[model samples]
Target chain A: MATRTQAAPTTWPHLGLGARRALWAYAFLLVPLAFFLAIRLAPAASSLYISLHEWNIISPEKPFVGLRNFQTLLADPRFARAALNTVRYVAVGIPAQIVLGLLLAMALRRVTRLRGLFRALYFMPFVTPVVAAAWVWQWMYSEQFGPLNSILVALGLPTLQFLRSPGQALYAITAMIVWQYLGFQIVIFLAGLEAIPRVYYEAAEVDGASGWQLFRHVTIPLLNPTLVFSIVYSTIIYLQLFTQVLNMTFQDQGGPLASTLTLVLYVYQLGFQRFRMGEAAAATAVLFAVILAITLLQMKILSKPVEY
Target chain B: MKHVLALLAAVGLLLGLASVGATQQQVTITYWQYFFESKVRLIDQLIPQFQAQNPGIRVVHENFPYDTYNQKVASAVPAGQGPDVINLFYGWVPLYVDSGYLQPLPTDAFPVQELEREFVPMLRNSRFDGKYWALPTAVRSLAMFYNDDLLARAGVARAPVTWDEFLVAAEKTTVRDAAGRIQVEGFGIAPGGQDHHLIREVLFRQWGAAPYSPDGRRVTYATPQGAEALRWYTDLITRHKVGAIDFFPGANGYRNAFMAGRAAMIFDGSFAIGAIRGGTRAKWGVAPLPRRSAGGEASNFGSYWVHGLTVRATGPKRDAAIRFLKFLVSPEVQRVWLERVGELPASRSLVSDARLANDAVFGPFIQGLAYSRATFFVDETAQRQVLMDAVNEVVVNNKSPMQALQEAAAKEQKILDDFWTKRAKKQ
Candidate 1:
């Protein structure tokens, strides 16, 4: 029997039952690994190659230009404005969404009646299709006949130039985006709150800590992981912002002097509108670097484990 | 057993031969157009008729949303997967030609003399390297569309034909509320509409500066004449009090406002007539675009979407593509397109037809074809944007018209410089 087993081991490595199971596990993992490499990594690698050349998507000739495309992007004023707007999205939008979402989540935790219904209602906008939501927001922000302006008129107050004004368009769009994504942040915060051991809160109460102190000490610390995930996830979404700006701005897109233009929208304008595929690819590579850097910095600062 | 085996083998061979014969004779070709309700409807209706006429050929119809249509074509043609024939805006002819996306029409089949004489001269814009690349079934020209009751209320008897007269009409026809907010605009200010053409082709040229040289390399619109032309346009929004830029603000906002009787006058195109006709219960009239002076050179802007054969059509697919192209441009199809799509006929003969030419709503647009010039845009999207930004600089940012025009000229010149330099390199 020992000789036969030795022969089997030589013929097929991992002949034992545990080793066979391990081999099966590796086989199953290869499917997703192959999919990820093909679907995500291959195009990314190809895009990097294309960025070094003057790629005309239609024409056969894609002349190698090395760093010239990047040089053009760095000098481009439109690209500068788009990058600043992208930063504004992350700076203004993420904090507003997270704070509002956390407050709502905490408030809902105390409500006993129809708790599930409230959660479902709040979560609906997150699940709603973005195009439909964007158009709805556009109609709501219309300078002339939108309901918000109508309300202002009925109250004998001045109407605001919401989406049309250069000064207000960016913030107005950000507010709508915050509203759409708030429910997601709330769901995550609730799960984080639930995972906190109950004894910490009870022990704080027994030690004569006030309600505010209990929240600051017990609740806030435990929710750090959730907060970090939400911040990083929301930042990624805002960096690649395109659909809302495209739909809400409509024909003269990203305007009132391109107040709402984002880096992704600029990439689209370059690649599709101008057919400067090389420059667009260069812009995309910059965006990828910015995302990676910001996310890494966030993890470094926020990844402390709450041992308690 | 031998006889049965031979019989089975013979049956199999005969069926295989029949299939091969069928496959050899029959071929399918594809045509693509952006989704406009009327164009899509007519094309969908015409496919069966075309197939019936040529039983051995099949034409497939594909339509994409208007906004993403160009991008779709850009990606599809390069990947060798899109339509054999594509309907493109005439302004895009230069871009397509530069990219080698189009295959020029054969001179033997589509003679230059016949095309020059038969079609409106705008098809001349479709020529590149001295060869015609595309043809149109219908054409469109900018015209002033007015709400009759609103104009009458202002005591204006007919549509204003001169710039000063039109401004006077606009000021008088405008209605405001107690708070001085406009309830009705005299002239709808939508740069997204034909107003861009109004400034670029008609007013600028009529004022004194042709926007570009005939060869289209030089940017000639930065002169004093250009500043004056831009001043007149911006003055309508800022100083005139006849209309505001953001009063109604989408692609069709001004049109919708006019159709809803909220605007008295709008510089729109013949293509807008169908939407205005279908959307409103009010009385409306179409007039030729206003001139700088009462007898100024009757300048107007004309444009059309043309059917072009793509490089994708080759080998057996080329003949089918050409046949379908002919079907699309036939006299019968043009007449039906005029009725259904509200664009004027591209054929000189059909547009000059006594009955159709004399029709009140179409007469102004038809007359415009005589003097209308289709701008040879090297980059239509970028050029339009720079113009829009210039206007916004005046109305929104409070910049001077001359300064704005000067800046716009520099940007436009950069685009031209980049294009020509690259084209020279490629050659």
Candidate 2:
């Protein structure tokens, strides 16, 4: 009873060399894993929980009202408008951005002189601060004193009401957003264009394919991955659009009859402005579902295999 | 001689220990406010004075950018870790109260009778649920700010007195290029800006109907009078063409236009006087807003920023916050604020002082107090957005005034109903 043997100098056993190395690797990853769990996943799960409860941040009580927030959302006309507007942004904005990006990429690929300078010039807007770009667009879109109107007037054409009219405000903001992101999409498409083997084009020419046919049959199919990525990326960005609309329409935040209201903007308004955290959480949950569904669908439709 | 030196050292050590004890007993309270340059400077000066008056207490003043201040408060106060005292916009009071973020002033320390006697009538805005929740050092009322150079260039002799005269003056001042593009707008119509207040409170009140019901429980702007008021307001842009919908683009539109001498006339609050005086080289004059008719009832919109004690503040910290608030509204501090910040003192006695009442720039705002009404709102920004939308629908979307007002009323009523319903549930 009482024979205390000093434990044989303790060392890691039962771990094979491969297992031990893997453990060290896992140990190295643990920090980021813990960080992600704490920062991103925890808040995401809590938001889902908050969506089911009535919360006002400072209130002592947070009563659970299961599904009530979502039910209210369905009945909310503003939510409907916001959802429709978001759809409109993606439907119109994404394609325009992609097509414009592809065209610019194709044109730039043929030019060898000062190609890098041209590329940098196009990419400048992508790197510029969004707030600064938004303000510049706001000034350019001003109905009365804007440079665009000035040009139209100088040309003896009637000036178009840009951001001022509800009918045109959404399109004006969408155009700004498209322009701001076009450079990024173009760079991606250009990289994709450069990656396509020149042998395919030469082969198409040897087969008596015209320029239009070669582009349609060879380039378009091969560029599917880039097209898919840009479409998915732009869709997510357009769905979560905030800064441009906020800065351009600074007067009302989201106004001109809520014409420019997007899903994320509505979430911000509900959470920060109205302090309806429960409704905001529910709206965010809906936004998450929409983003997930659209991403999956885009992957399914656009990510089909392209054979050589 | 050695013993005498030891005795002196002992006494010096005792004094040092006693001073440390005194310093330990002192309490420091933090105060938060939105950034306003002159106001912050005045507050900075007053902090030392306050510390001197109450030696056992020290105040730490912090400020945030205006737009994010409310969000910062909402998140911080709930975590029991915000400033002991806060200065918030009067419009935000109801929302803060609903969230239970603010503590009602202790009657023993701040009696209602004293507040009523000391502050102007607009102090009524600070009272809710049978308790006074906050106090204000200064108040503001809307008035017309005209660029004198622009007006004189157009040959308008003086500020217009009636709506008809205002229309004519605006028309005369308007300068359009040969292409029919506006070079200088005669008047600014910023539906999402200050014009929102003009249409919602002043014009609605001038039209012989309140924007909301007397109890402030329902929207009342869907009526014929409301539509008529809105129609007339929109006519300035749609029919008279003196002002356009986007006359002044971006935020702070009308005020910026007036400051830049692009717009001849603008409706703004007394708080803007300092900015106008400092930022603009153009000569500007403050005048009372024109009435519906020459002899009709005069109405103006009033708003103020109120300093509140957070519910999280307790014990000696709470007591210190109260003491600081008392010192803040003291007549001496109020006078300092007025001189530095260009704000009308909230204290009735100070407001009526002959020195302020007779000043040409301050006179109109002071005179407007008699007929001014502070709008009661659950969410002032959201409600203003509704009215702004109505104006936009008419001016931009070409919706009829009646239809737009009707839609706005329904939306506003829903907001009011939601506020009351939630409040009822909480109670």
Candidate 3:
């Protein structure tokens, strides 16, 4: 009786159609907005709050330590190395993903036969379960009797310590990640390529433009939005790099002198392994800040106003 | 009106009886442990037996991958959920106790004196705050495992009894290529495995130093004697060149190499008895770890996994949890675990089993228990990692032994400080 005493604002007799529609839209939108706030924003805020305190999950007492955890992180060499490694993952991994993805997409655009098969072959790794892929990669990278080592032996080349060598472990992981993510990048690029009308290409050719000139002028500028999105997305992924390094590395704590350690893996070790949830939360807060700042910076720098 | 009131009271009494009947009929509880294939299989076999014995209580076993097991419990418990009973490495007891993740075993059912009398001395490592937080079915200590054929080929009739003889045997057993690349490592130097334990418990004590203070709160393994012990440990790799850290190059690489007969000898726990027996074709034997000098005191790192009743089990479930723990630690189950999982019986009575003490494969592990010392850890996994990092610094980066040892000491001391500090806050 109370709910039906008066209808909601959307059902008012004097309201205009647009106003009524907007009110109803908002009423429906609140469902998802509340869900987003609960599932995403709430936990993130709570995580930030937890970062300020000495929060061990199993313990009931969570006394606030007031940035002491962060202070510890600042002095932690593992934290420093992990942060640097995260940046390296982004700096080295993202560019390879972008360039290789673009090349593969372009080549696929040119192919006239077995197009579906080629696309499927390229995309399979992305769809394959990461844990499964990591184990396979671990075997392939084995120093003794791995398939890669066998190839090296057959070619009379020196065996490389792919995961065992501290200097090379990060790069080895980056290569695997690049291979796995290339399909996603390529698919996005292919769609961008398709959206570009053929008339622009013909228009360039008639003006005595070479193929490279046409690509440089026509394709590059038009693909600006797609490039910006990919760069921002890939940057986020590489910054939060974890599974490949964790699953591929020995003993699963980013060993080989922690060369392949990522910020997320460090956070995991802190919270779960060491039972220092406060430190882990502080580490995550730093990660969140880096991710947010880098993403905003990328979008701002890369987003150009394209004109036809 | 009086007759109607009487009928209502009878109905109420019947409903109360029905509810009591339901509560008494059955209570289901969950048990959790990390997945190791043999342990998981053994637990699976035992759960039914436990359920059958305790007809009113049903047991549900849940296993997670060893890597993420702790994380699963930590996250689940914060949300007011998880297992009624849990299994943990003995080293995790302090952390679990400090976090209040586990409840003290009911003293009425498990008297403190009786527990002390029945379980082996090493089981006392898990005790905190004047109460036993967990109990183990089996416990184990480190022993030297040698490839008999490799020793025979090197014309060494027996495993070395002293550090000097150990080096000579290692040199003779090592197989090298024309280019001096090691084909078969004389010693499987596994920092990931029990070698860290050997250095911490065996070497430090043998050379007249202790890894930690009496209370296990401070790091004290930074003395000249400590350096001598550690140098000798790392020297097997860098100075002696009998082995390299990356020879096999993966998780449990050293153990895998030993099982494949690519490495002549390795320090392992009795837990590897079943795995080694199954995985290797080589004729191998177990011997006591080498001492600093002949006829010196024997020292071993004793460790075990324990099952505990958790705080999550409340009221009626507490009894079921305790009952389940008792069945898990029973002598019959411990004996079967010895055969199946290769962990030694934690029972004091089984320590003198004639057949076990005289057996070739199990004798050394049993004897080592007489002097075994469990490293009471504030954080088991991290403390292990600190030693690994120390070893890696010396072996991988070519740092000095003393430098690595000092850095490791500082790091471990910090972990202890942070843990105790937080614990003090709670108290």
Candidate 4:
């Protein structure tokens, strides 16, 4: 039978018309691939190239100074502070948003009355304009006239400089970010929660499991994918903290002592304010690398197949 | 087979037709500005007037809110999408100049020397690099606007001419409740704010110094005069207790408090003249800012000048733009700018015209313009940010005046070094 097959000539090599059809199918994908290359990849690649040069955007002449812009950025104390602030924002904000999101989701799952209305109310901030929300936070944090100060004074508590204190500004900004974005994660968690089968909880109840026992044994294990989703999404968003801090801080002081200055704001200020486009581009590349690494790690750690 | 041939024929026709429709049309010149309510009216009014003046050319006017104008302009200029003429402040000149985004206004082209000769010297702060980069359309300066009814009630006859007399008036004007809580402050100056520009300018001149060196090249505020200016401002809140941060609740809260008659005296710029008059029910009068010390010189503070137009070097419609620019700066538009918008006209001739001089609110604003000085530093950003930062440190953080000034000077020096080093290397 093997000899007969060999003599008949491999059917795969004889399939010319099928191979030609496959080539046409591959050619169709080239449109989207070309678009991705043109819009996204081209700019990123150009930014990487430009980062190695010393360029004033309007100058008639440009000369390459390999990695000098990066060197300058590294040497600058402000950049280091900005990096630390960004790390702190991500480290503190991501976990808080996820946990809070999950808890709210669970609570919402159990509620039967006005669930739709409550869901919409909770999700409002997620859909609100970040700039407008930031401005609202600024009003709330207003030292003298804000509602927060009024409440504090009424309670006989010392009025805190929420955005004015360098020490407190970063955390205050992070809290605002978390407050604004938590609703989004909550909605995501809700969708994940809805996907879980009711039979698992029933089975746990039949097994004579307590409330905590059921959650610990069955819920936790089953919600692994949801937890992974929240983690990965929140990590990406938290690392790019900018809008709230930029709007809240006075133009002169990026932070009280440059505390709330994030990587994205720094890139914008350097490129636009300082006219250091090359340095800004390099910082952007670094930001991209950071996001890529975290995303890869998430996939590796959370991609295990589950046994139901 | 017939359907396939027809489809191919239609596709071929569409492709063939698409190749023929590519040609550049009439050039559209973009004008970017930050327009107030009144300014918007004038801008709208001028479009037809401008079009009538230059028939062939089309001007696309873009307006933005006052707050984000600077950032928007800065970002747009480098991308080749910036307006042919941008309404900008004098402080933005250095940044645009450094980046080579601005085309210099030659003396011969715009007759800047003639405009300079006609415009007030104080308003000439917009000119830079020994050439005009911007035309001053409207000038703003610090002036003392008081509630006449409140002043009369407080038993003060007129605006104080000297610092000591001002304090005395403030003391007489302020009122407190039974609990010793301040019910009415003598003056409403927002404390805990960075850079009280109007107040600082008056003090700097009183001490016989300016914010920066005359050349806009170094830190001149570190001198004794600048330190004296710093102290005088600090004393207004800490010592005199006339104006306090605690009194002004938040940003612009002091101004609102003043309007509400909680404060007897308020020092601000011309921009507030219209708002103060309209926003409040109280009878008000305007006066020049109080002098520093008896016989000591005083400077007008808080000159917030707007940007005028400049024709781009490579622009095709240079002649059309120049004619349009001239008309925009003419006395007719200046009158519209003054009467309609309440902006102080940049032209000396139009300002001296009887119409503006007769207005009660603008009279002092115009008078104060003669003494006005632009805040200048080697790095424009340093001049703006460092000063504001220092004020915040002193007023909000309660740092000593000398310490704040010293810290600001150090920051300014570092910025100056960065700017000069780059320039030197280029040379």
Candidate 5:
């Protein structure tokens, strides 16, 4: 029968099912692969090429300037300030968001009553438009007319200049960003919390483990993956912050002496506002490198091997 | 069946021919402007009238939010597609011209001598590199907007006529609560908005030093006169305590504060008139900006938007755009723009029109136009940011005025130098 089958039709080459399956999977992936190559990779590569030239958006000619754009960026004090502000945003914003998110997640995990309602309420800001949230925050941060200052005045406390004060503008914007992203982090943390087997907790409880000890030895290690993901995710978000700063300081984008300028905002100001596309591309390239380095560093330090 | 099929084919051919004929006759040209309610309404009205006059040409008017307008134009133009006609801020003309995004009006169609005679002297700003790049249907100049009710409450008789009087009036009009918090601001220090214009044009000119060199290649604001301008402006917030940098944080802060009766006076352009009329119940008056002294050099900020054809426009589209522009700048249309949009007419002939000159609110703005000067900006927005930063450094960060002005001047000069250097290399 085997000889007859072999002799009957040998139209196809003998290949493993796995090989055939991979070929079919790649065939299916071709559309998305081509899409990424066209939209994402092409622009990224062109941005690198554009960084080495002096080309205004409307200019027909793009003169090659070598590393002059980068040199100009290095000399620009505004760029330096923007870089520092971006670092401050990630340094201050990420931890505050992660801690608050984790604390909220921990509290909600124990609450059986109104838990879904609470979860939805916490997740609301994540879904809210960033521009609307920024406008609301801008009103709240107003020194004279805002509700926060009104309350402060009502309580006979000195009103703080929130967005107006250069010293305070960055922090105020960071607070709003954290508040907006808190809901998202909380949802992620809850997912991680739920995935922890209840048997482990019950087993620990039977062994008379205290809450602190149980959290330290059992829950913490298991939640490592979630923690790593949140840190890297929040880090990237804060690193490239644009909308909040843009909306809050709409008149003079990234202002009150540019205390709130982020790397991305600087790039935007350069490319669109200043009509310096080459310098803007250089700034973007710097941002890309920064994000790559930080993400790799995060994976190296935070991600641990998980064993069942 | 063959006859029926033949008839059907004949009808299809005729319909296709008709469509092609119709399309060939209609030349649609897009016109874009930054969103302003009054301007939008004016354009909405004008488009129908324009189309009625020119049946073969169809005008498509589009408005974008002001913040994104420049970026939209820049992106759209480079792709060899954008509005055939565009309304650009006067300060942005230089940048657009340098980038070759704008096409100068043909000399025969828009002769320089005719433009000089018809339009305000400030229209010379549109003439760059010996060409008329754009034309304004209407122009705006800074004027003092006062809340009459607040002025009465403060016991001030009228808007201040001099900077010294302005200060005293501001101090008297200012109200403070028991805890020393400002209950009402006397004046809105719009550092983030028009304060740059105020310092550069009004104050600097009054101090007898032009803000920039005649060639527009160097910033002259580092001079003693410019230093004094910066000092006086910051002192309103710091020493006088009548105004604060945060009084109105956003773009329309001064206008909003004045309209809300929170501020007794504000230095804003004629553009604020419509918003003031619509927004506030407070009695208001418009006056020319107060001078450094009662008889000091009279100067006001001449900032306006001009309509021009983009470089991408060609053939029938170019002809259509120019025709539309001529229609827009026609006396009748200019009058419509002035009456509806609250901006002064750009036409020199209309400036002497009794109806506009006799109007109480527009009179001051029109009178101020004679002394107005439009700044030559490489990148007006960026240059303004430098000025605003200097203001912030002084008022918000407590930096010395001289120090801030010096730094700003250096930065601004660098921008000018860079622009000129690039231009030279391109040449």
Candidate 6:
């Protein structure tokens, strides 16, 4: 036993061929690397270059105007409104979605039979296509015959102009977004909850710790990893929000007064609608930076080093 | 080794035969269009006619809702999977043209000049940037649609002819609850939706202010006449209490409001005539838009352009596409499309036919086309968005018309200035 403990493990000296084979395996990855560079990196780099010039995509001539597009965007009132709306969406919408998701996950965890079925039902909205989901929501939010307002009227309550009101339009759009993404967060939280060792809960119970105390001490600390994930993921998604506001609104005005216009929508409108591709690229660059910072900040605030 | 080689040779021969068979098959032309189910069925019936007219070419149709059609085209075209032929709105022509996605019609194939004589001046509305990007499938104009029963109830004998009379009629016809909130409005004008027509374009004509300058270089809406026209529309809701700030908000259609007796009168286009029939059982009458300030040489026509077919600049099938376009524009096809979908025929000769001229609906429709003026197709996106924003600010937000127009003009001028300044460097 003493000799076994003292003896050094034999190191393979003749495995040079295997190491060389591994190097060859790494080189084989060049195909996928090239694909990633073409699809993601190349387009990103091109967008930055194009952003410096005034290009209308199809125009025979492109006039290179340095920093002019950025200056024009700074002067645009629409851009300011869109930025404010985006900030508001990420601030309010993300937190609400995460909290609702966590609560849903806790409730679902208690179901013993057909738990998978219940999980599927809750995940359905997240899995549904964005276009179809948005259309259904539009119908539900319809001012005249939508089931939502109709029910309100039936209850002898005033029918709210959900999308048509300047004050309510942004909040209404946020609610739809939250509803769609909350299920995703819940699934993540549920997986995290399931992974927690049950022995700790049993030990706390035997120690005479109440439900609230156990949750405060054991559950909250253990769920930090999942909470961080939810925060970072939701932040990135909410920052890049676009399609929801585009399809639902009317008058191409971003409605009731540019209330629902967000950053990505603004970028899209600049590039596609206004043909200011340079400014659109600049806006997209800014959006990427903002998302990156938010995700980093979230990680810094929520992440905890696991102790062995 | 010999047996494996024999099997491989057999497989190669079979694959060659299959490839040859595929190449020899009929060319399926994908046609993406925006039409309702009824029009789709009618087109399906007409497809056999087209197929007979052109041998070996089979047309496959894919349809989408009008709202999503352009978006679908935009995403699909870039992927090289777009339809061979597409129906596009006239307003969107500038965008398609600028993107270099569209092909100009060959002069030899369609004979634009020969077809021009067959069309009315209003049908020439499809011209943009000195090029005919689209051909008007049919034409329509904004007209006063009124509920006869509601007008009768309100003791108004006839439709209002002038602005002052219209206000009086609206005031008379309007009903309110005990709370003094509007219940049954006399005229349904949604500042958000139809304000451009109900207020701006109509009043611009009445004030004798050209929507664009004579040179088509700048917006002249900041002139005194344009300001007056703008104020007149704004004052209707603020002072006259005749219009609604949120008019029929949500999913309520303005035309449906009139048909359902929710409002006695509404301003709408001929495209809305079909939808109105399904909204209510009320007897309705169509009339001209109320004039600006009683009998001041009434100008009462507003128009929107329909899509035209064009051949691509660089496509192997340009000739075939133009042939299809010509066949589609024939008088017989025009009549069938117009009759089925309420699309007013662009052909001048077709409009005056006894069948179209005598039909109660088409009587006003054709008459209005004569008085109609097409909206300017501004190539500048900044100016267009600013103009739209100004309209919303003036009409819906109840902003000062002068201030709004001034701001719009200044913004538009800056864009123009930027364009020229940049162009100088390029030269």
TM-score of chain B of each: 0.89, 0.92, 0.89, 0.84, 0.88, 0.82
Between candidates 3 and 4, which one is better according to TM-score? 3
- Candidate 6 local Cα displacement, residue B118, angstroms: 4.5
lDDT of 6 by residue, B127-152 (tens): 65556756655677777777888888
* TM-score, chain B, predicted structure 2: 0.92
Against the true structure, whose TM-score is highest?
A: 2
What RMSD does each model have against the real structure? Answer: 5.3, 4.2, 6.3, 9.8, 5.3, 9.2
Tell me which residue pairs clash in candidate 4. B88-B307
lDDT (tens digit, per residue) of candidate 2 on A247-268:
8888887667788888898999
Alpha carbon lDDT at A179, candidate 6: 88
Residues B323-388 of candidate 2: C-alpha lDDT, one tens digit per residue: 999998888988888888888888888878888888889988987876677887787767888898
lDDT score for residue A245 of model 3: 82
C-alpha TM-scores of all predictions: 0.88, 0.93, 0.84, 0.77, 0.88, 0.73
In order, how many clashes per candidate?
0, 0, 0, 1, 0, 1
Worst 10 residues of 4 chain B by lDDT: B191-200
- Minimum summed lDDT over a 10-residue window in model 6 chain B is located at B305-314
The superposed Cα distance between candidate 1 and the true structure at residue A87, in angstroms, equals 0.4
Worst 10 residues of 6 chain A by lDDT: A4-13
Off by over 4 Å in 2: A1-17, B1-28, B60-62, B65-68, B74-79, B313-319
Q: How far is A21's C-alpha from truth in model 6 (Å)?
A: 12
Best by DockQ: 2
- Docking quality of model 1: it rates as acceptable
Better of 3 and 5 by TM-score: 5
Task: Estimate, for each residue in A165-220, the C-alpha lDDT of model 4 and write its tens digit.
Answer: 67787888788888888888888888887887989989889989999997787777
lDDT for model 3: 0.86
Reference contacts reproduced by model 4? 0.09
Ranked candidates, highest DockQ first: 2, 5, 1, 3, 6, 4
Q: Candidate 4, which segments miss by more than 4 Å at Cα?
A: A1-39, A53-65, A194-217, A250-253, A273-275, A301-308, B1-88, B95-116, B123-127, B146-196, B231-267, B302-333, B349-358, B377-382, B396-398
Please give the fraction of native interface contacts (Cα pairs under 8 Å between A and B) kept by each candidate: 0.38, 0.59, 0.36, 0.09, 0.52, 0.19
Q: Given candidate 6, what's the lDDT at residue B76?
A: 72
